[model samples]
Target chain A: MPRHAPIELEKFVPYQLSIVSNTVSEDIAREYRERFDLGTTEWRVMAVLARYDGDGLSARAVARLTAMDKVAISRALARLVANGRVLRRTHRGDKRRSVLRLSAEGWRIHDVVAPLARQHERAFLERLDADEQRALARILDKLLATDAAVR
Target chain B: MPRHAPIELEKFVPYQLSIVSNTVSEDIAREYRERFDLGTTEWRVMAVLARYDGDGLSARAVARLTAMDKVAISRALARLVANGRVLRRTHRGDKRRSVLRLSAEGWRIHDVVAPLARQHERAFLERLDADEQRALARILDKLLATDAAVR
Candidate 1:
């Protein structure tokens, strides 16, 4: 047995979301890429690291938080470390696990980028009303929760 | 003086949208990849072509519609044609421009996959209420419209 359904590519939620997200991300990435010399992957890793006031996160934790694979995280960390933006430390008790945190320079860059990121988000979101904004948030939250549950 | 604003990566709309969209896309892609042996790019081209009941579209039009790069569209189209899922025609008046349409086999694949895609969307949306669904749609529309306007 076969079933058929009409689907418009433009109206598909996943398609729409991918286009908008990619556009917004590329737009936002330009500033970071040009001025900060950071790629999106590096910025993502830095974003996670910037949040912790103290004590760095393990690579596994960063992977879990960012939804990026270990290879990407490792590559970004290498670049950040080489740029002197991220500081890597080995836990005293565990030699096997490495912890990562933003260096003073990393924090400095984060401080500069975070507000700009928010401003971009605010500007993009300005197209919608406050109610729409709230609803969007609620819907995303529900989707994320459900996605997690399904996985 | 430099201005600073606190930003939470998890709460950021762009980040959230990106994560959710990527997750949904990957989840949906698995079924098509496994069952139909079609990549995301190939599926996208086929989806667009399936909508046209008659005259086919050029690769450029497909790129515009799908937001995919020329190289990807070319590669996907090549694969689809090779797999006997797509038929290419040279217009009688214009020999230079080639038109693309799904083969009967392509339509069969689309008939099978489209329902699965809609089902995924439905299942994902089931977590949100009717109001939330409407609001999400409205918000996405506004964002998309604004994005197009700005571009």
Candidate 2:
């Protein structure tokens, strides 16, 4: 009988990607957590709102794009609204729809926050070189742009 | 007066990589959590133990590599030890070092667990053809190899 070979999670791309992504993200999140007392989800919401255009998300769009549930986005929006980092305005064309946009303070925080984020990103990507960053960017862009299949 | 411009998170390389990575990771974690009540830290411990090497960790290395804190690694290792998924053997040269390795069942679970993960990866990358995949692979390799300042 053949011996059952041992499995190493490092060989798995998803697992490896998860490790890489989460490690860097956790570092970023922790920094924000300590410096601004900002929750990760809240930061993400504000970040998204800061860049929103048009009438903004239809709840479904936010959920789909952010991979966050509608309920969670709704709750986060509520907090953002209260914190004055975001504004929720009714959609003129679609009465049922609401727009999410960042407030002035949100941009203030975002400018401060994003530069710090990039600094961390530079640190995180320090493992790779310039050519590698381009390569990684290409790969990431391709992966995100296409319809990911699981087979 | 200068008008403030909104920044899109999607335009950020790290953010894009994270979004794609997280989508697949969350799916796999859901499976792991459903099958066995494993959190991110515990699952990472399992992976590391399964891939143990001569330069054994002292909880600190694991914490550094996994981006988990020492306390979290300690707790996860304790759980893994109690669950019998990991075995700690004493180092020959260093008495202070306890070499962590996986048990037979641990290897078995790893074997079982990674296929689903691989499929997830393949699916995620399926959007890109061979050229694109190679391009992506090259990019990621470069990014991983260098760090990102080169660009």
Error of 2 at A88 (Å): 4.8
Tens digits of per-residue lDDT, candidate 1, A41-130, equal: 999889888765467899888888888899999999999999999988898899988889888898899988988898889987888888
Residue B123 Cα positional deviation in candidate 1, in Å, after optimal superposition? 1.1
* Candidate 2 Cα outliers beyond 4 Å, as residue runs: A1-12, A23-37, A53-65, A88-101, A110-138, A148-151, B53-67, B88-99, B122-126, B145-151
The residue-level lDDT of candidate 1 at B102 comes to 85
The superposed Cα distance between candidate 1 and the true structure at residue A133, in angstroms, equals: 1.0
User: How high is each candidate's interface RMSD, in Å?
Assistant: 1.8, 3.2
Q: Please name the candidate that would achieve the greatest lDDT relative to the true structure.
A: 1
Over the stretch B1-151, how does candidate 1's per-residue lDDT look in tens digits? 4243546888999898898989888889998999989999999998888875468899888898888899999999999999999999897898987889888888889898998999988877777888888887887788888888888
**Candidate 1, after superposition: displacement of residue A108 in Å?**
1.5
